[model samples]
Target: MRVNQAALDVIPEARPPGRARPLAALRHRNYRLYWTGQCISVIGTWMQSVAQAWLVLELTDSAFLLGLVGAAQFAPILLFSLIGGVIADRVPKQRLIILTQSLMMVLALILGILVVTKTVRYEHVVVLAFLMGSLNAVDMPARQSFIIELVGKDDLMNGIALHASLFNAARVVGPALAGLLIARFGLAVCFLINAASYVPVVVQLLRIRLREPRPATGGAVWRDIAGGLRYIR
Candidate 1:
């Protein structure tokens, strides 16, 4: 089922004339655990986002270069989102997320080290952002679809809404916190903190007990992508 339809299936009947309990999705054990992990991880992610932008400006002092950084990061996503969704369907979501999150943490740490040691250059930031974008192209679709696995059909919409709330909250807090840290210490600390933040999520993924999914078969990879598009359409 499409994730939206999956969630709608579980949606409680629109209020029986009583105050609604919007946070009802948190009642699910898996979703609660996943939500908690994401709350921490996304905050770190935003910190990294802000720090990266600032680092780019510091290195090059050009708005055009900053735009290039943004484009480079998203170009892969623009090209590969369809393929990413197909891959997410084929792979176990939690395992894929764990791998992607770990890779991101490592990338952040590498940049952190370079910044701290005073060896970082503009080229390094561009290269790293491109790497991050490539990972994100896969990571995002898997993540969005994985909510159903966490909360099932009964609380899918609530789970998705809560997830968005968590992300928005993190976006607000992360950038503010990163700004403070960047001003006081340096950009490297933001990156390091982001790296450390991934631990909770990785550990959480390990703790999750999910059944292995049956392998998907839909002709070749290109065919799978086309099928997903047709399904979405």
Candidate 2:
């Protein structure tokens, strides 16, 4: 039978509403690459977190110091996540994520070398924790928002849910893996593994293709920050 090819070409490429498939977000190529990379990287991140705590306790033997390390690691997020959100809005999310991930990889490598070389001190752990936290302040917002670009709004919910699932799963798996590695090899291995994990994420992020970011609206930085705060409120 003869067909109207021109009419066929005009049909929109979208899933019908109420007919979303299982694992809907994984259908997109960009999201698949992102998810794969994240699966490895987040597990490594958790491993480093576990190793860091263990190493801190081993070095200082002070619960207060450990608590302080935890605070230093999270305080930046409390203070700068808002700023990170603003930056994420202004910059290309993909490139920003790559930069942040690369920085984190370097931090992990530094800590690993210090531990391996027997030169690590409690002071080094505290400072690295703070630096990692600061980087996270920038990375989290960009990484979270990047999912929408990977899967588009249609699968946004699915993409976010999948990411949450990945994080929780890693939390369970990574700590257990870290414990085993520490017992078998030493703490340095966990940090080194974490550093290696970032390589995949950076590579995957580089492979992702997205359109150029729109020009940021002109305004004072403080004014933008205030506007973001108000919007959140």
Name the candidate that leads on TM-score: 2
Candidate 1 stretches with Cα past 4 Å from truth are: 1-20, 231-233
Per-prediction TM-score: 0.89, 0.92
Cα lDDT listed for each candidate? 0.86, 0.89
Top lDDT: which candidate number? 2
Give lDDT tens digits, candidate 2, residues 1-233: 98654233222257667786769888777788899999999999999999999999999999999999999999999999988988888888888999999999999999999999999999999899999999999999999998888877777898899999999999999999999999999999999999999999999878766555678777777888899888989
**Number of colliding residue pairs in each model:** 1, 0
Root-mean-square deviation per candidate? 5.2, 4.5
The number of clashing residue pairs in model 1 is 1
Worst 10 residues of 1 by lDDT: 2-11
